[model samples]
Target chain A: MDLQTSKAPSPKLPHTALDRVVPHSESDWNDAAAPAAERHALIKSEAAGVQLNLGELWHYRELLYFLTLRDIKVRYKQTLMGVAWVIIQPLLTVLIFTLVFNRFVRLETGSLPYPLFALSGLLLWLFFANAVTNSTHSLVSNANLITKVYFPRMFIPAASVGAGLVDLSVAFLLLVALCFYYGVALTLQILLLPIFVLMMALLALGVGLFAAAVTVKYRDLRHALPFIIQLWMFASPVIYPTSVVPQKWKWLVTINPVAGIIEGFRAAITGQHFDWIHIFISLVITLAVLASAIYVFRRFEDTFADVV
Target chain B: MNTAIKINQVSKRYRIGGLHPGYMTFREMLGGLVTAPFRKLKSGNGSQTLWALSDINLEIGQGELVGIIGHNGAGKSTLLKILSRVTKPTTGEVELFGRIGSLLEVGTGFHPDLTGRENIFLSGAILGMRRKEIERKFDEIVAFSELEKFIETSVKWYSSGMYVRLAFSVAAHLEPEILMMDEVLAVGDAAFQHKCLDKMNAIRQQGRTILFVSHDMAAITRLCRRVVLLENGVVSFDGEAREVVKRYLSSSLKTGALKEWTNQHDAPGDQVARLRRVRVRTSDGVTTAVVDIRQPFGIEIAYDVLAEGHALVPVVEFYNEEGTELFSTHDTSSNWRRQPRPPGTYTSTVQIPGNLLAEGSLVGHVSIMSHFPATVLHAQERNAVAFQVVDGPAGDSARGDYIGPMPGVIRPLLQWTTETNELSPKSNVQSPTSAGNS
Candidate 1:
């Protein structure tokens, strides 16, 4: 109630047309009176549901790049292997799969060599696995940045995916080497490799978005995430081929979006028969998951700073 | 005037004490999800709502610098957070014009593993700067940080001071139409803090609207022309910076004079002792705001000792109006010094003799400690009691007849004696003549 109207002396500067001699109050803020060149930003609380503010995201794209770069640069900072870890991780996983599934269990991998088949699937699977794991904890890990500055929160998760893509590209080199070592011939179907990689990336991003948002509220996801990823890897056809599954149970495997992508990737790399029905089903499920993940991510984005 | 920022009826509500803790476990979440309907039917509402800010309305004009001053949890940071878009309010809206760069904390996005140079670009981008802008200002930022020799070195090797310098330099170079800063000056050394203030002054001179939130009254008064004082999530006063700061200081003094603990669970103490009541009173046992400088005053600290056979020492610290610690006095009474205190409620009074303190507001801090085992029974309650010391009548107090502001925290009335000699005139004349001859 103690509102003293004694205005402080204004600074001596060149006055613009917007300058006024009157006092500032709630009633004096007329949006129509402001010039068109003057940009205005409004802040509010009740932003419910999913609003993909693409413009805001686009504006902060540079920040996303820097964040992704930071993640990659810091990922291997003190490690002895550095970028070698990216290649070594998937290569080692493929070796273990070939040993356990091919040598011991003797799982059928169609006509393709077991190492070539498993490496192709393992390469994409590692990308998706690392991407989802990193993106799920991205917001919480950067809680300082989220609470201190104003940027699109989606950039944190998206940058995790972007950084994962860098690792994926590096690991892809190892896959090419493995294909040559196994004498697997590349066919025209290999041209569809980028599209399938994009689909797998989207599937990872969708799950990452959902997990990131949920982790902000329920930190239990942080503890349960590795277990979930372990289960998801077995659910996909990374260790074995999708063709070995029984016909009735094949529908259950296709429900996982990564299943068909892995199978399609192996086909593209080793020159096997491409399954159009499986690819189509995987693409549709990936799109649905991506759309809903984005929706859920945007819905929970407003509460991230508060709860995080 | 053209408004730079308009906040209308913005209220933020935070829920308290629900079945769900701040963090949720998978089992608890699953169980809650299953019984949510049943729990909803049984309990009307399981959580209580606290409005951190409620119905706050304000408008800041273009090129205006405003300081926000408040106690902790008075919603000062909340307002800054809402304006900066770091968090959203629960009700109403806020409109901001022009580009806004908010520095809520120093070194916000700094990655220790990254080099100082890499962190500069990363922090710059995090603060909404374009890569081109950072590239342009790269040398200037490095120069300002004074870490040119260590720019390529990882930030983890840099000292905390160097880290703050680099982080602040990047943020300082950010050119925004509107800037919001919250107590970022509290870090770094005093010299660096002055440099930051100089940079802030330069920013102010550019006709950019600035919203500064700080507890340092001197900085607030020096930088901001207008001040908004918030108390209990509402604008308590809005006026010139000096006047509002004075009001805030006096109000804090008034509130710090007395504290009572009705609940033992909520009292300030450890297992050994707990404070029951703390009061500033006159020698006659009357609680008053003003204490005459010629008369003694007392700080009555009533505490209950929860444990027996513990040597508890009561220490009281006095601070001036400027938050400068005047002095600290400890209870060395023979009774407690010789024997351990038994478990019982006890009242201890520390007396401030006349002519010992300057004529200004003095804040008292009370603490209880044990020495042999080196334990603090009760952490010091800073500003537990505050009282003003006014000058007494002329010829009776430390000030004597002078009616002006004293220089130091303590003005002791020391006695002086003068003796006149008959040879003093001759000596003075001889001394002047010898000096003139030389």
Candidate 2:
């Protein structure tokens, strides 16, 4: 008998103390013996609209924490390198770019080594790319949870973005060591590094939520996503500096929020010129994309359980 | 009596067999958008809409354990889904008074790659348990699952039973004020099922409101005092548990006491014999879909003998609602035992005496067998007819005024002889009349 014969404890009765009082009618629901009224909720069949309920999101914050932890843990479960692979992805990309650019195409990188400049930009780029790609498929992958349980559906895509932060922070430490080896002096501009990372997150979340919701209805996005991302990577200044773009075509960097953030991130780390106008424009676009993505996500979320 | 949940004028409509069905890709959807205006004239009539639920209004009081039972497509799941807020009703509102938790399925958010220990916390949080609550009762959950030895092992390697145990253990510890379960007890081994039932009973005693949806009639009748029966997206019956369960079982039976084959060429049989019709009737020979428990009923089977020179026997098998075969009766008359009938139609009937069969739905299977040099089944029909056996309030049958559920497939009234010993040293023995009255 593999079953243990230990006596299971009697489950706790939450209402035992209160039930000792005399019974009351339904009208006395707000009385002392009754459950607090704040727990009451009314569910209806109306469109969610564009209402933002921060309190509801706050209530399910623990679920977001657990889901993000699960993603991070499961991503490295079977791999031999585990967290080491997190640093390896950006390092290997920097290695390939450094070899190709330094030997053949000599695009001038200001003051700092070309390898250091590319690694700094790839830090934000890879996080944005990985976060967007993973969150895009998060809803479809967790279809079982969507149909069976009730929670903030947005947390699913949001957690994928959160998981990418763990990898980003680990890769950030390697960039710090390389900075010291290159003897690049740090300055007050480095304080703005966190702002750029925040912008990158908002942008990824905006695109991820929209794509995840759409993919639930039209699955062809799953096949077209990698190709779209490959082309998007070329448009962003990951391997090269933004200065390489001609002055007439500078509007490309202005509209691409990720390009501005990456350029801002590299500038901040190397203590170079900060593109204030471009960073400000990227912030505005990031917020707009996030707001609209949330709108489309909220509208489509009601039918996700039915169709997914 | 505070209302734990209230559902108001709820109705859900789903489009069926529509042009835009299930899911569409981006390209196909784009094509739909281009041609939608042109196709609008033919679209409305081509699609069909089905109302899964219509005008459902229910107010459940706090601390009530209710059972909901219905046949497939009866809208039980739809109602549960609405209450749990998994999907919204097309038109309705539901007000809930407390922290609502629903276990529509076990192991819904389990990650197989995570270890048993990690999954316990993850699954617990997904089921709406606070991290501190889970941490406080973590050991209890592991103990209840009985997988303490393998807590650190990945769940992918655990057997299915172990996985269900871990998932259910996390769910069992959830202390929601109102919980809705949909056939969650339909798994696991018998011993584990018994343990789960015990845990549910404990939860019920804690004054938590529970809405249980299941097809297990025995469990429904045993655990719930109130049962609701849904039929065709409407509430058909709501009251005492046993009565409603009884109604649900009999109503689920095929609504026919008689089956007939109008075309003899398509009837069931080889060249030897063919069945034409089968029916259930009382002693008065009136065909009925329901009969009294204390009244005798007959199954009449009419068939045609095509090329018969061999002796044939007609048989009828009786089964209860649970598909347990109660008894089988055959034509045993000596005159027809070895008699070979000429090519013609023959009618045979089997009489089941009063107080012999249980008070539930009974299904009859009719067949004909040829017995001469070798025994061979010539014609047979499964589920030929179904009829409900009802117990009267007078209780004159084998139940004999005892109103509780009688545990047997057949309830036969038998004679009993009682003899009191006069030479007994103990005076506690009462007289026969007194004893019988008591």
Candidate 3:
């Protein structure tokens, strides 16, 4: 090691003598000092508390838009069905539910036609399910970008959630057409559909933030994520009405945020009484999950580049 | 002058091969929960960690183009990552005064299914350009890439050269206040590389700060006024670019100038010949790790000639600092050219003339060939020995009165003649008259 270190300085034989003559001019030292005091950004190993840099996120909102656009474009490109798959996916699922639950199980949907009831539920459920699944894999899928550039890591999972909105809107159109075909009367309550959809998106994004962060550390989630989403669908009242739950267990079913949104979607479009208690519970739960998810996501954010 | 970037006591620690899985399954998490107490009792720290970077401190003034050079795994990329905020440092802090654009990789966020035009926008946005900014520079980026014809074609269908050209063009057109690059220019052909360098030079002239990391010594020397040499996760030296590069090359070559094969069976060779040792030495036959530009040097290759009646030609190829082959020479002795060598160990020496090589490191690739039958290579060793050629007193050498780095691979002292002939009075007087008549 000593010999190696000794050899290092000798290679610059021509400049060694000259370098001693002029170590560094005062102008050069002053130049380096002048700009350092006015630095706009300071990155430290540990940030202060759990505060997320919302300002930075706001500055990079355009990147969020572009990333979301890329996901939507890439998802449809080269597919035979293209944008039609977004509609077909839920319609087919709704058909299966109407056949299996309405026809075979003879499930009651509180006077609403089974197809109308199932399509509305399926639209929101599919968006939530797809958002959760896609956002879980978002960070790992964009590992190339994560390792190469710096942006708010939140954008990856957020983009996944945003991209799913495009699909949700397309599927919602089909649901509206199905309601008209079934002669379902639209009411003032139906104006609240966007709020329910927003809640569902927030719920998905909340869970997705946690899952995406975890997926960076443990990749087994990548495979198990779809299975989790499938199980979560059964847990939520996507196919059946919450009224079908045993009177004693109704409280348990309403704890699922999706149940309230899906149930609210049915009541909204079919002119049923709005369930404020259940909607309020779902909003509280969604906000709680989203808050904690952001906390955990930011906590693990620094390690994503290393772990991924 | 303002400071563009400042790093203070930064360090990065990475977990080495350990059971700490980065991606875990539900089963593993459940299992970990079940055995949490036992695991904690058995091992204090779950995994072994290696510090990739340790206590790095650096400051760059506004408009300064600094180069960071190091051997692989010396934490050059880790430092860049910390600077670019791709990953947080384990300790200390970094500050930047201006909008930073990092090209750790060309086309980093490019989707293969997206067309060239779409990718230009996508990549530009990923690198922190606004949509309007991309729209404004879109045509210039396309022209720079020379990919007008393929702009509508998906990048998946693009040849790799086209992909790199378009990616680099987008990155080159990014007019950030501070730019960080990591070996992205190593892609593409030589001409494209020069174009990129020229673009970087223009960027520097605009008074923007730049941080460049590359293994290409020539590029670093040409583009960077200052260089920081990282060794084993720490800054070993930081000074003038030429001086730092020279230190880096020599330190890297400390063990590279000599290689000995203690075990014959494990040596690099075929059945016909095997290498014993290779060394670079001064004219006095004393082995030296570096050579003086004004002094002659010798490359000594010792090998065993295992078979009889086989003529062997020892060839030495000299490559400049950029890894471009300057020239190749073979020992064409009258004895070896006419006759076959008896089976024995033979030492081949090739002398490099003084003042022939430029003042930089020259890497010699040693190979022995059987030229008589089919010109088959019996044994070859790449980078067998590397020796630095430092500039001696310039008066007697070709670099007379020049204080800057020389340009080419070879700088030779050759004779020159100049003559001045005064025109005859008769011809001089007739020239004006003839021109006026015409």
Candidate 4:
């Protein structure tokens, strides 16, 4: 339980100051005779170890909670409609996707109504997308705090994702209601819903970490991230069902992790799950991407506070 | 016993360079996204190493009050960040033995739209105080901050003074084992500043450790027992207060007091006399070292009093850096003071030192005196010289050779005023100043 040795008193409290002042002069300031800057250089540059120190993180849990809550509160503060926008954003997006894919492109929605169908995927996918994208720049955006006090740097991104969950849950209630409104029968496959949702969260976190790390070193990522996410959404099966993809290119389609998540989403709510082979492949690819994201993020984590 | 905070060879390296301008080539904005990221990838991280602190090793005993001092570009902030753990060191280690609470910048971590009460919880949590602990101290914090009525009001509407009082109150009230504050005293109005200083002293009275950084030398002298000076990312000095300040002051080499020699005397019949360069220094002009307060000192003025049909006189003045005039004197015997004078180079001096100044930079002025502020006989001033003071080694003998904290600018060698009453106990009455409303 003792975090510190018994020797030195923690120099963090204010006491009766004796004003034992020691002044240093200009000749002392320009102490070229001052020693050279030294550092612990033997650590491997390519192999920074992974440490999930839950205790330290736990010690700071309340701070984590407040910060996440702050983000959620601040997002809607001074705004019209306040929390209503949480539902409107997803609702509007569903309408746009329905128009663009179902009406114009005329993609078949099988037995499910196109609006109800796409809305579910949109709600879940939107959360994953928003959380990932926002988390990507969380650390850099809060540079003021990052540069001033010490806390687990990972909490910044993690909190952003946590805050997004509130909106996700709100938009999701409408998705659930829409499925029932469409006369879709509830299936036990819904049990697997949380699994895919989690996978989506992890997937976002991985990509987000990589992007956040890259953004600090190159601010251009700020401009590129939205474009990248937009293009990525099309590549995923959000607009069209994975079932419609031609067999010849299914290999490439399965490689995209979101492809499996969206298809699994349809099967979970409706009854048309994608091929098991593709779903498993998507899971594997998602894990691989996440591991790489963690690795890349850890490699550059120390540099973040400096440049940001 | 081991030190409370042991900084072992800690050093931080920052990258130096700017990010590449927006995406794509100069032509790419017009050409679209085709030219970018073809085969190679290019984006953000472009910086080199700028070591903020190098080979810094120090062991702070438990409950030691340490003050950090330095000029612009010095690594004082960097060192604080490292100790507080906001930023990781590129090399070395920081071994902390107790809880650390930092007030890096007031009102920085507050959310503008959040009510003052919400911000208290938020800021407290961010400062590492547990929820239960904050709940316990909640009322006391509000009472100390004197914002009970405005607690529910959002910080956006809080006046700057109100904001500072609330923010500083929260930080000061935090019962952390170690506290790190940056220039917290150099803020707000005089009354508020006094309150902060009182609170700071109270915090120290409890056996807790603290690290403070300030530009106000007098405050530093009053607050810190051991002062460390940094210059250009390195520790410049680490000794007694008076000695360090004296060395910094007397060592001034401002291009040997520039001489713009001009003989524009008698250019006009009315503006006959002209003034040359004026320089202020120690009585012994050759002793360029900083003037010591314990001893007497003088400022020198040089001028050319040409034959003038009009009256001419010279006035000398002294002012602290705050522009507060300590005192001023003049040559009432000059031509302007009495009659006219012939053409010749003349030197004038002003002298004083007996408990008349404070421990800070002083500037002097020499003006051509005339009919109630009317100039004509070279009414220009010689450059102001900076001098520092050191109180005798009498008070706070524990901080031997150090200019300990004392009230007033001059820090006079005054007698004591004291009365020892019954021990009502230090436990019951909390210091009646700002406390954290976390």
Candidate 5:
């Protein structure tokens, strides 16, 4: 049905009658607004040479601290066991490994007791495992903040690893007590334990950052990561000493970054001879993986906000 | 004048119906990797690209309070995201001077497990505030939120209002050189909204550049002297706040004084009835988008009843420029008000007298509902038709001789009575005791 009107047939509605209708202003497209000599942030589609700017990271250090603090607070507040769980998990794992390793395999553990031997390796392994696990899901879990706010995206995975450090410190107390109970004497080699721990941390962070970035795009990593970690445990010297492996397969142990770090860490705690070759191999692999992981992470960082 | 933000040829392209659907599973990625050669043979199929923004150029001067107004999908949020560096544009560059803060949402990064006190610090840091800055403004933020008693309690237990209050308070205390807020004030109580408005006004006085995106024309006109209207990822109008807002509101309602659906199947309705048309017309039966304040106008709703034995009530609601619903009316004078409407077409009209609505853009939403047996709303259309109420300054109508801002939802010319009683000496000089007794 047509709209009956006294005037001509019209399909479009007439403009509303108002006093002093404002005309469209001139589109003052200013292409020549000279940039002043002031500090400014320029956001472009392609970031200029994704630099691992230490200074920028230092500026956001407080955010990194707060995010880590938030993770620790929230993680502890939700559970009844709280920090005690950190000690209990590693302690029970050490007990089970000690019992099984002693009964199943007859290998010389030198002078150090099997329990202390397993605990030393287990402590560093557990820290590395937890840090990797935590950091892998960090980007996906904090997708809210990543999409809404602007900060160093790496800080998310970094904070997850940092939170694990707190737990490692607490569980370190359990290792010290085990040493005291076993009447183990203090030695100069214990000073190198921190270096091994640093190597373990570097390896964990490298793997974690890589996993976190990839997990943002492929969430199946979340399901597959646990299985990978479990297999990686057997590959490392968490349960048995690396000497038992055949010479032909020992090269595999050398290339396994965490295997060397774990053996070196146990040696430092037990006052055994340091494996300089293995430690050097671990350092090389750790730095390489860390550098490559950071490169891969920074490459995927720009698209995170859009896809996450 | 120094430039605060210069958006140069910025554009954002998003892939639609892509192979991965935004994110992929590892299984799918591996499968895609295996079938990459096969998929290359069948390329140019599913994925479509959308340029959310297209070479939009804008230069905002420092200390300018600009309001960005647009409809949904008009790329206002995308622009803000690009400027705030939440996401990078597909092409183009945005330059910003000084420290910038963008609040696309309040309480962003707030964990429910954390206490209100912890969230204040966490959220503040997320918004780019320093720890020392948060500590310095801690008490002020708490006071602004009016949530001092529950500051230590976990946010999970706080009411939504309290959460919003806490979130907005922290955001308000941020002292960035440039602040971009997207509809943050659309929450909280009126009093709290006013407090936020006051805080924003104070921020403006500090010569800090602010970019506000909101659909609330009232707030836009109140706070921003300059406004930008975006339509389909392009700047359509950029000028004075009042002029830009008027164009924005009117342009949104420009489908005119008459809306019709000839196809019964495509009309908005259920099985009971379908709305065919909604029209705003003068008493002379001529459709119009503008009406003189001194003349009565009628909003006519025509609908087709598909099912019989249903008492249908045609309703019309009027809203002003500020989005306040002035009033609603139904066909209470209908002959079939108590009877069932037959399966046929019907028309209902509600006449609104002149000088009853304030002089501004008036939008009407029409609906058809049934109240008998069970309440079933068949159709409801929002902003169906809009008309401007023109109240000329001729010393007539409700304004009389007043020539200033008339702030009210309605401007009805109601009757009044007055009596002038001359204050004689007898009553004016009455004693306090006598006045109390009287």
Candidate 6:
């Protein structure tokens, strides 16, 4: 390496836009009881990294927001009606599902207008699918960056979820409008909408991180993901109401936690009833999957640059 | 002084065949796999594992900018990946104090459909920059990128130059404390590249430690004080930038003359004059050669004139790493002679000078052809011997009047002009003046 650059004057003076006010030194990092070499690097890594430092990432959280915003704008760029696509997308999906299921299949929506019920589930699915797909391809496709530079591996998957959140928010408005059109009165249970959103986001992030790591090593997953996600949508109760599911098979529904979340959406928005059984089961499943995802993501994160 | 980044005994390995070209029927391929377990394990071409970097130990002090350079597959990229934490090292460790900002790629996370302004924030965020900072530098970055007019257009519509320009602008403008740039210079044209260098130079002024990589030797020589040379994932040389480039280029010279063998080896299209030994010698016809200062030297290529031909012209060309053709010479006058030495051993020697060529590796491209009805008997796009030209007395322009670095690859001996006034003319011009002093 021609280090004449070391002799090159410091970066254009007034180096203000750094991550931390107190620049961390290599020596200071070394003092931590991390592995001398690989272990040391692992220490700082988000997983098996020496330690997880939320404060450091928080300092640069603005970057995360910018990335999320970038993703949102990029999705709608060039196509007609930029931000409108966010709302139009779910609106169309709701229309299609309502036509196919409510009008044709005639699935009972349990006192809830079918359009409002379908959209509620659609909104959550969009976030999860987009997040998982983006995260799966993030490390491999960003070869230029991942191979060239390093950052927290989780950031890529997390940013995808964050970016998709903007779309989800815009799409959620349609669900609200549909509820109003159907004259479903607001209830205190609506406050719990955020908890479902968080659960969905976490679920998406966890699966997305796992997919991103696996795709780096197994290219087959790259090809398999879209089909798997499409199939996964069917497994979740997006197109139909969970009430029709036989009580005996309800346990199988818990296998796909989105089923529980979708049922919760129906319960919260319609103010009919809560599926505490499915919701509790869904939360547990989401946590198990998330912990495993983090563990797998961290395990594979170290090797990402090489494979990617 | 605190060390900003410390890497010790780091290594990275990759499985080859990410891109394999082959054909296999679906059923048979699966059947072979299924049966392989029953029969002796027939290892179908096992994947090759190559280590991109190994046993690298270095300490980067706080706010130290380092430039890394190496030949293709020399593990420079691998090292950068490890430093940036993009990939885990198979062994060894890296300890870093401050958050590292790596521009591993310009517009790495850019969504093509995204508008320039949006991509900026997105790419900026991916690089670990805050939205507010991206906003603060938004105008400046746009101005620097020279894409102010089309800021809202999707980046997919932007030309490659515009994309690179905007990408680099965002990366550098975002201002990470520790920055890593990899071949970022390869994207822009000459003027743009110069502009980028100046911008990078400006960025360096902020005391942010940086790591830059490029293929242009001149730029590398000018920008980097120290360079690391990697050979097979190991540091071969780590010191002065000039010396490392010199070492890398010099090693390219041929260690021995081309060997001669008349045995029946498959020759390209039998029409080619069977080549024997290609040698270098002095103008005096001495076999051994090294031209003294201001002395001339020649290259002697011996071959058997396998077939009769007319208008045969031999040419030699030299090139630098940047694909710049430094010089080429074709002996047109000799081709006109057409004195056929048919079916016999013949020697052709072209004389130039050892001192004339600049101090660098000069590889020769040789072509043999018959130009009667105009036919190329044998032509190799890239061929022949490489030699190193040692510096003599002349010096280069960038570092003037030195005992080294003669200007521009060739220091040809040439005549010069000076004017001295005639005695009678001087007397007439000074007639009204100093005559009385004599």
Question: Using DockQ as the measure, which candidate wins?
Answer: 2
| lDDT by residue for model 4 (B136-255), tens | 667767876789999999998999999987887667656556778887677787656666665655556655688888877666655666778877677777766655655444434342
Candidate 3 scores a C-alpha RMSD against the true structure in Å of 10.2
Give the whole-model CA lDDT for all candidates, comma-separated.
0.80, 0.82, 0.81, 0.67, 0.81, 0.67
Q: What lDDT is reached at residue B245 by model 5?
A: 70
Residue A211 of model 4: what lDDT? 80
Native-to-model Cα distance after best TM-score fit, residue A113 in candidate 5, in Å: 0.8
Candidate scoring better on TM-score of 1 and 2: 2
Of the candidates shown, which would achieve the greatest lDDT relative to the real structure?
Answer: 2
| Cα displacement (Å) at residue B129, model 4 | 1.9
Ranking by TM-score: 2, 3, 5, 4, 1, 6
Q: Model 1, range B160-261, lDDT digits (tens) per residue?
A: 889888998888776667889999888887666766665665566667799999887656755677999999889989998766866677676555557888
TM-score of chain B of each: 0.61, 0.66, 0.68, 0.70, 0.64, 0.59
State fnat for each of the candidate structures: 0.69, 0.62, 0.64, 0.25, 0.64, 0.32
TM-score to native of every candidate shown: 0.74, 0.78, 0.78, 0.75, 0.76, 0.69
Please, what are the lDDT tens digits per residue for candidate 4 over residues A166-270? 787777788878877888887898877777787777788788878877777666677777888888887777867766878897776768888887778778877
DockQ of 2: 0.32
Better of 2 and 5 by DockQ: 2
Which candidate comes out best when scored by TM-score?
2
Worst 10 residues of 5 chain B by lDDT: B429-438
**With candidate 3 superimposed using the best TM-score fit, by how many Å does residue A232's alpha carbon deviate from the native?**
2.4
What C-alpha RMSD does candidate 5 show over the true interface residues after superposing them? 11.8
Better of 1 and 4 by TM-score: 4
Q: What is the DockQ of candidate 5?
A: 0.27
Which residue segments of model 2 deviate by more than 4 Å?
A: A1-38, A47-50, B16-19, B36-48, B236-251, B255-438
- Give the docking tier of candidate 5: acceptable
Number of clashes in every candidate structure? Answer: 0, 0, 9, 45, 0, 36
Summarize candidate 3's per-residue lDDT along B158-236 as a digit string, tens digits.
9988998888888876666788889977877765565566566656766879999998775676567789999999999
lDDT of 2 at A84: 97
**CA displacement after TM-score superposition, residue A289 of candidate 5 (Å):** 0.9
CA error at residue B363 for candidate 1, angstroms: 6.1
Q: All predictions: root-mean-square deviation over Cα?
A: 13.1, 8.2, 10.2, 10.4, 12.0, 10.1
